[model samples]
Target: MSDEAAGRRPSIRDVARLADVSHQTVSRVINNHPSIRPETRERVLQVMSDLQYRPNRAARALVTSRSQTIGILSSSSTQYGPASSIAAIEAAARERGYWVSTANIEPRDPSSIAAGLAHLMAQSVEGLVVIAPQMRVFRALAAQPLDIPYVTLQSTELDPTHALSVDQMAGARLATRHLIELGHRHIYHLAGPQDWIEAEGRMRGFLEEMSASDIPTTAPILGDWTAEFGYYAGRELLRVRDFTAVFSSNDQMALGLIHAIRDEGLDVPGDISIVGFDDIPESAHFWPPLTTVRQDFAELGRRCVDVLLGPVGDSAPVPATIVPELLVRSSTSAPRPL
Candidate 1:
């Protein structure tokens, strides 16, 4: 049962011997030391692979005085954006041989955020990827200083140094402008919850575009970013009948809005055009196919890992900000004849 009785376990020395390098060089490669040359690093890693030389986490921690683990603080893992980003972060971290731990904090209370951080600390994570997109989350994080490095997956405007998020404002503008170009002067916005940073950016973009076009803005209908809420909002908007198009904050709400419109004997893109954000996989299969903005959560997640794991003095020069694109479909058209 002992390692020596079973042909002995490979150590850093074995890797160094096979790669024709010193044990210190092997250590540098394992720790991602910046001074190691690219060619030498590759050769050392190849020998490690050939020998199946897996570093022991316990010994490495004692030797390097750090955990090789990264923690993720996420808000809602059920939502598409947050869930996708979390998955991508895990994948990216695994590719670099770092373990990932996630703590989901739904409560907006400061104590909840603290509890989440405590959970990750118990695991001795070296760095953190924060996927809390609410305004209160940022306030909670800024309330105290952290010893370990942390990166945020929120609005770029929040933390210019470590933000990794898609341009929500630009995406919202693209959605709204699509309706405007189709000759829909009276447009309505179904915004998400007020606490969300993405919702704020999107609402700002919608208002900016509307004001720039000289069109008087109607009060936005705030929803909970659910298809059910969208349905209710759509049914209520029927009484007003003033707006020709509606841009929901996300695809779930947009689908619900379409259902409500159909139930009221109204046709999409004929009586009312609708646009949504976060082009979820099912958007294309919707009744008339959904026109929405597509954000690259995977790329955003990869960038988060790159910034957190890169060398201290040579961190990513620019914060990651993904640009969203408009995907046109059958869900939008010019206003019908009055």
Candidate 2:
């Protein structure tokens, strides 16, 4: 329908007029306020239905001193973790009748980060979710006090009260232990960039598991969470002596490693096995489907919004840790015989 033909959608005032009630009574019905009488509430609701009335979110927020909007500051929306988390938060907020405002942040600049936060504040958002995974962003958050409730997603060292994240360390341990259980004695780690919390957590998990097993640690191969970096790291490993299996920090990097290994005349599982994290959609389609850890980004986002909107009288902020599950696929196997 044409915008004009929609003929100016009906308003709360119109519903109130039809129901023979005050605007406040209509609002109480709309908000499901506990004090509203059942008969009065039903009357208001029926009138609203008859009039096709829609509440003006902004105007209502102003009257109640609430914006009913939440702000999200995120890194690239393409990456699996941040992207999935944002989608989840949006879905959860909508379920609760809240709106979402998003800001895309470049990882490098402090000013850009500040500007994004300023914009959300200007919009009068009731809460904020920070999806930046770097230490710098964490430092920025620490340096400033936020008037609205805020939470950090995937943060490793954040104050427990305000931080929510998947247990990357736990996920990594699951991946490493899976490989170890398959009789792969010489396991190597292909790590993500050191500055990222996901990378650090995965590395810690791998190390802890290896240490617990009394297996000597090999120097980790480093990458920037890119397919290209994984390819390079894979090529370098090809030049070194042998290892039975490799654990990559993410699915993209593992894919790169797979290609590089094949280019060097090796076959996955036949020559060496591989495991990856993130379990991106395409992981299953790889030449040999990838065995991986699946992080619940959506759950993380939902929990973040819940924490932000939770009653102030609730118990102190407790760090919530999400455990990732290990997905076994064709990419992993028992070690090759000597």
Candidate 3:
């Protein structure tokens, strides 16, 4: 062999030759096939290590006609929900002897999302999972005819046939109901981006609970699910002196709202109670621990994969909704009697 070939990364054929085994045997060993003899397996494994051999995933997929890789199409993979969900999906996929390929789409436009989906398809992904939380994405999905197996994460009104989501509405209800039990009658909701499904679901849940209890359903205060928006909204809220409690769509907004309220000389759980969603890692460390809903993104990821790989059969598409739990903390308290 030329020096150039010798210096290149070791391939399956190299290991096969070194171990005196056929290329098929090496492939089986790489895939952990059960039929390989124990002694032969050890020999092949040692040769692989000596050669520093690594299997080419693409080549393997070509051979087996199974990529064993799922495609994830998402916007803002760095954000709390999508980031956590992606990590969870990766872990879950690894456990199932599969891999993941992620494509981060910009602004979650229908065209851009469609392009990302096409890119994943080109990679020969076995399944697709879309993590765009906006209603527009669902509309885009409706516009396209995706014949491949796919699922969506927490979309607003997705086709029941191809979508799955965490139960954001249920989580919001849990938060609202908890506050009601604490004697908070006039609750204010700090909503996330008006365009996001999660924001809408949480708002809907809060309204539904209030309506069921014969409480008024006022329009929610809109924010962009950012600490800056929360802070700004909180400052504006100080001008209206009527609300007893506030429920933010996510924890970042809650944190900013808390800061804003404190800056206005109002004490948390003393002057006004507060609650947030997502149960972010830092919620416990806030000035007053944040009472929030915990959405298990990891579980969402695992279940998405399950639905994608499992037999859909003749069963109609049924969207899976994972319920979140409410974590009671120091941020909430009984409202002072007016």
Best of the candidates, TM-score: 3
Error of 3 at 74 (Å): 0.9
Per-structure clash totals for the candidates: 0, 0, 0
The residue-by-residue lDDT of candidate 3 on 61-120, one tens digit each, is 787778899999888687898899999989988888789999988755667978888888
Give the local distance difference test score of model 2: 0.86
Total clashes for model 1:
0
Which pairs in model 3 have colliding backbones?
none
lDDT digits (tens) for residues 1-338 of candidate 2? 34653587877767777788998899888777999989999899888777777787767777777888999998767788788888899998987778899998777888888888888887789999988887777888777689888888777576667778899999999999999999988999999888788888899999999999999889887788889988988888888847989999999999998999899888898888999999898999999999999987777776887788873356565448888999999999998874
TM-score of each: 0.81, 0.82, 0.89
Best by lDDT: 1
Cα lDDT of model 1 by residue, 42-123, tens digit: 9999988987889877667767877779999988789988998888888888888788989988656788899999998877
- For model 3, the stretches where C-alpha displacement exceeds 4 angstroms are 16-25, 28-44, 311-319
The residue pairs that clash in candidate 2, if any, are none
lDDT of 1 at 125: 87
Runs in model 2 deviating more than 4 A are 1-59, 311-319
Candidate 1 TM-score over all chains jointly: 0.81
